[model samples]
Target: MASSSTIQVKITAARKKTSLLRSLPLPLTLSFPPSPPPTVRDVKTAIQKAHPSFYTVRQKLSLPDTSKALPDDSAVLFDSAGDAELSVGDLGPQVQWRTVFLVEYAGPLLIHPLVYHLPKLFYGAEIEHSSLQKSVYAMVLLHFIKRELETLFVHRFSHSTMPLFNLFKNSAHYHLLSGVLLAYDVYRPAFSAPAVAGTWRANGTLLTAAWVVWVFAQLSNLSAHLTLRALRPAGTTTRAVPTGYGFSPPFALSTPNYFFELLAWAAVCALSGSPAAGLFFGVSAVQITLWAQKKHAAYKREFGDKYPRGRKVLVPGVF
Candidate 1:
């Protein structure tokens, strides 16, 4: 009688396991020892084990009925037992997740400017002669080339792959903007002509001063990035307050890199002598300032009193 009762209990447990598996959404199934509640990380590991293609770092596990992503992968899955059903979605429609390096992003941004500029320089006779246009071209090329090299050797990414779709998005953004800036500032007759059209002259001292600022800002920005990269070692996610060349307080405004970036773009505006370039700088400045504020808040939250309280968000003493 005891043996018979034990066999029936085993059968019931098997049926319960089968039912739980059936209730789970497609392509996701959890198996655990049942003594301890499984964690979101555990589930992610199981999914990766089963799928082999879904890497834990890249995987964005979410509930089936909502778009809100799980915040903490280490949280207990059973804590939200009622909404325990999970689903896996690709980074984009019809596009499976694919890994891309920072260098890949940098390479295209560097090359695209040259690809657009060289033809214009060779074929467009007016642009070929315009020193102003040539100077603008040189600055743009230098900026992107420096970016590419920095991405390759200096910048350390916390996450390895951005969503594959971002490659298309970012490439289009940089390439299209480059085209517009080049078209308006470098190729256009009204903007590129000397002493006749724009307020600033092609070979004027103001343009020379702008070029100086651009070079200084570029070097300063490179130094800032190197300082940031050094805060954490390779393959670690440690965050530390950045210090060095351009970062001494009260000059240590929030995101000194962004401040330097603004300076560089402002130089481009001066070099181009176009209102369009100024507009571009304005838009970029707003965006970078917003990002800087966010970074500042995050630093405060993470480091508490350890983060410098005197640092401004973007501009020192003003913003």
Candidate 2:
């Protein structure tokens, strides 16, 4: 048998060993706080209330108390973390989820059906001749193309709608509508309306040039929108907030593509010999080029050293 003192010594050693084992540190587990979904109204209100400058001077702009950054509640703004890169759709959990589910999915679907049917109905009612109908149909086709792009491509990733994005979308929608109207105005009404008689005929070389210009402009516009749709998808790497200006290739002005579109319109006016078309296209073209230039200068300022210096404004030297 073991001695009592030996037994006690053995028990003490066992207890010490148990204590050491118990004192060993356990692995830590991370617990993330629950994030709630933001409502559409919440996001909208945030944008309206937020500093106007936030909308204006986007690149390299700062927010006060950024450390206490709040969730984006609006359909326009996304709140993402990190400074190196952030995108319009990067807002915190609530805002991000809301954007994907509500704004992006619903808006395009509602717009698409209306866009397609309206042109068809209007064309049948007003355009009588096959040639006139075909031209109007082409305009209608372009409308559907733009709408489909919004639904199939842009809505795929974008949850929140940036102001610049909204502007571009609105402009496109209006431009297409204007084109359709002009076609109808030329074909159906020109004959009946005394003042519009010779001036509105679609056969003039100026009109032909206008049509050609429109076709090329459509191509360029589609290319630009598609390229932007690919790069600025939602949940992608966020860099600067999308001004909807998009990235232009080097050796080109801010939006050389838009400038091409302007020229296309000018050509159309020259070919058509329609004073109305000339006035309308000329004014719109000037406005669009000016807008592109303004946005380009703003971008150059924001990007600083990264911005290309040699790129001209919309037109090479004339601008």
Candidate 3:
């Protein structure tokens, strides 16, 4: 019923609408060199070509002001047409990419004690003259050496890489603490005096009991680590609820390992018979307890009803 000219106009209008819809750009725009917009993979490839240092797995492409990372590298850039225009080097002004590497945790544990011990040997601390000092040094060295061996063979790290700065921080903490313990035990006149030192010597009942407890606690802690490692087989990522062992209450403590660690340090404090050792153990206890509580809450949230209901955070029955 319409005129021929009107019909032609309607047809042209429909064609123009279709063309407009077809020509609409994607939600995201990447400023890169290409005739048309490329796929995310193509963009990554282009970036890699430009900078060979950026690896695909390690590098994550993110928006300028948002924490949202691109989920799919295969996604076409046209799909993100309506988003803000992205430009090359727009990640941030101070964006410096860093390569990540894994260093075994054992290395620092073994190395930190030398910071104090080597100096003591050279500077004449008279550590070897006192049996208590010798015993304390032996215990401390044995503790960390065992830890290093366990880290190398028994433990599995949840994360493959940590920031390089963390290495220095961790090393500093251990090095300083080791220095404090060794210095006080070896150099202090109070510990070397026969009246005070004889009570905590290797042959003394108190020191012997403390040493026994330390040995037991260390062995138990190692057992806990091995048990945790066994929960997940090699080449798999799975978390399982830990069962208790030895003095640990069955299914009643969420972090029996932390408990054993605290006990071990407490024994070390008793063995050293120094206020500094006690202070270090107290501080360590608080830190480890806080960490255990956090881990407990995380486990409860993650596993929900499946998580054991009666589990304490760090202590077996008290905490």
Candidate 4:
């Protein structure tokens, strides 16, 4: 004669095992026929079929499952298959796939070299324009660049590209390594935060503006990096090499990252607490950005109508 508690425990264990078996869905090894070029109906069916399992698992795992079956929307089915047949790029979605690919990959990678080199290159270099804010920016920018590279490339870089590499070799890798060194100087007080004595009528306002601009620049840079990583083919190398830039189109016109860099410089100027420095770097950064933007525009024009239309040369909407 088992105790009441023992009987209850036995029942509970059996119930739990039953629940696990049902949840496991018997690994449908029946090798169903290969799914055909997915129709809109096919996609809907697939989504529906996966939905119940997804929802059940979600509930078990204490997660929310918000996805629903695809609506009977009016369009050709199968928008963008990764490598499947009759996929949805040219004849499927409203957006062009090649352009999408460029934006997703090339745009982000364009700024990699800049971010890669900033910490190593500009950290302590006296500002070319003699602006204290610009100098601080150069340093802070270096710091941010270093942190970003650590996040994005820590596990991604080849062993040869990680630590000390030949800095004087004049190769792209050399430039990249050099930039990292120069940018690193900004982390020190001698490079980053020595209080430069000066007053601008708009120093406070400008500082605020500069902070905002720098924030946008950082966001834009981060966004580009992510988009590129997402777009890279399945088997490509993940190092911060320049190959990612090659396939990119000027989605926002030309040198869109250049635009953000210019904005960052302007913001640094405003925050410089000195109008003279702010004014100087503001002018320089704007001119340089404009030139770069123009060059990118020319390249896009040469590439023809495939380039995205009506987008600003750099800033997303308002140039």
Candidate 5:
């Protein structure tokens, strides 16, 4: 086996398909160690060292044969042979992935409460919200509050940044698509609008059960987040397979955070019965499922047979 420092790799530039940019330069060679391995960031660093303008954010690395881009985080990329090749695409103007996430969540974080509390401005009258409506607002606000705090403190992002245009698109989804729309639906002048499924307020038994379940689900989701955070330590891009409370039987989703988050949202949906809330829940489920699938595949590739076989993508035994 070649020493870690002696493993050689070819870095090829993946240019834009436009004819004007078709005339690309030749590939560059880099030596990496198999022991430590080369992460997507490491390859980007080498490219930047050789070509100053191709910084990390603007660069996308993938296996030579595949166009699917590698995530630029603690992701350790692929196993390398002495002659393995990586294709690096120039993604153009970029911003930190963290920036985009924070900005996106920030919009709804502020907007949800603003519209809920100030009825005169949005509803155009000094209207009082029903007890049920108030409870819905509390749940939604707390959820995003947890998310905002987690993004700032608990969560560790894999990718450093993304295309600049993504900021605008992502913010709109939170601000308008999910945020403003849901706020309007829940806090509208007609207080009855929120009950899309059924009115939990009318049934004390249902209300108690929903709130209790919602609390547990939120805590479970948080436990999953902390477990995931513990996998990657400080000042390094190291990663490992995750395990803990939420990862065990009965709650054994490959990505437990999303599963728990969905569960929490389900409680909210049940209590409010708002179509907008249900729609948001549906969108979140679909998106989280896709993310969970990717993470599951990544865990398989990174750990080989070491990754647990029992773990399903988003659901425990079903999915």
Candidate 6:
């Protein structure tokens, strides 16, 4: 039955529709309001409601006619007729996106402390930590705590969920490498002594300078976060060109909070003088830089002329 506001969407398994056309599985028919036009996520949510076990993350919704996957935020448009055909490709498993961020950031916060405080667990014996080691403990804990708090309170995610595999993969990056490996390498007894950590360990001038830079970097990062947050109002997924405070014109590297994070890590490298610190900084720089580039490109494509030009992905004046 057709209604004035309700549009019926005929959805089918993408693979089954093409490969098993002869079988002709009955498409799952659903009704959605044309007004405020339902989003791809809304359609997927409805399908999930009907089929409790259906993993929305695994499903790829596409048009039956053209068979192109729809963006999560894209509106499902209807023509003069109130009927539309959509396809779903179920992948496998799903997890909340927020859970992923929390797990990733929480990794360093928990593991770093454990490895630092319980030296016997990893080091195989009682070990006295150096002043630099204590400072590193403070820095690592503080950095990740801020990230956790921000993820909980500051950032508004556009997407509600992600594939479950991201949970394990992302956790490994933070928990295994950044958390356990870095903590062990930095706080281990080998790097604790001045002789091994190098003369830089005793350099008060450099220590003071590094600490100062780290503090400023953290503050600027927070500022950048606030500035970016102002772009999208709470409870809405609407995006706009980032403006105010940390953001600059052209937005290439305008208001680069990630760069500030790297700067703080660089200060950690200066303080700890550990190979692990160097490795962490190097890896973080590369990964974050790539992410920045991708984000910039996405913004450009989304906003077009509205998005300011000339901003590099991460590095100012350099891609």
Q: Which candidate gets the maximum lDDT versus the true structure?
A: 6
RMSD score of candidate 5 (Å): 5.3
Query: Taking the tens digit of each residue's C-alpha lDDT, what string does model 6 give over 149-227?
Result: 8889888877777888899999988887789889989878775655444566756777788889999989889988987
RMSD, every candidate, angstroms: 7.6, 17.3, 12.1, 19.3, 5.3, 3.8
lDDT by residue for model 4 (111-195), tens: 4345334534534443322244344535454634544453445322211121112222222321232223322332323323333
Clashing pairs in 5: 4-33, 4-34, 73-158, 97-161, 195-273, 196-273, 196-274, 197-273
Please give each candidate's TM-score.
0.73, 0.46, 0.66, 0.34, 0.79, 0.84
Clashes in each model (backbone N, CA, C under 3 Å)?
1, 15, 10, 15, 8, 4
lDDT tens digits by residue: candidate 2, 99-179 = 333333344334433433454464454323333334443543454456455555554443333334554445443444344
Supply candidate 5's per-residue lDDT for 174.
79
Better of 3 and 6 by lDDT: 6
Off by over 4 Å in 5: 1-13, 17-51, 61-87, 192-200
Candidate 2 residue runs with Cα over 4 Å from true position: 1-137, 140-144, 147-151, 154-159, 162-184, 189-212, 236-251
lDDT of 6 at 160: 72
- By summed lDDT, the worst window of 10 consecutive residues in model 4 runs over 5-14
Worst 10 residues of 2 by lDDT: 5-14
- Model 3 error, position 200 (Å): 5.6
lDDT of 6: 0.77
lDDT agreement with native, every candidate: 0.62, 0.43, 0.56, 0.38, 0.76, 0.77
User: Of 2 and 6, which scores higher on TM-score?
Assistant: 6
As for lDDT, the candidate ahead, 1 or 4, is 1
- Of 2 and 3, the candidate ahead on lDDT is 3
Q: lDDT per residue, candidate 5, 151-267, as tens digits?
A: 889888766677899999879877885689888888886774343225545566777788899999999999999998898886556788787787777767678888888899899
**If ranked by lDDT, best first, what sequence of candidates would result?**
6, 5, 1, 3, 2, 4
Tens digits of per-residue lDDT for model 3 on 1-319? Answer: 3222100000011122232223222232245434333445555454445445543433344444444556433453332333333222222112111111112334334543553456455455543345566566677778777766776677676544444455666555555555445454444545554635435344578767887898888988888888888888875557787775732455367777788888887876766666666766777787798898898998899889988787788876677
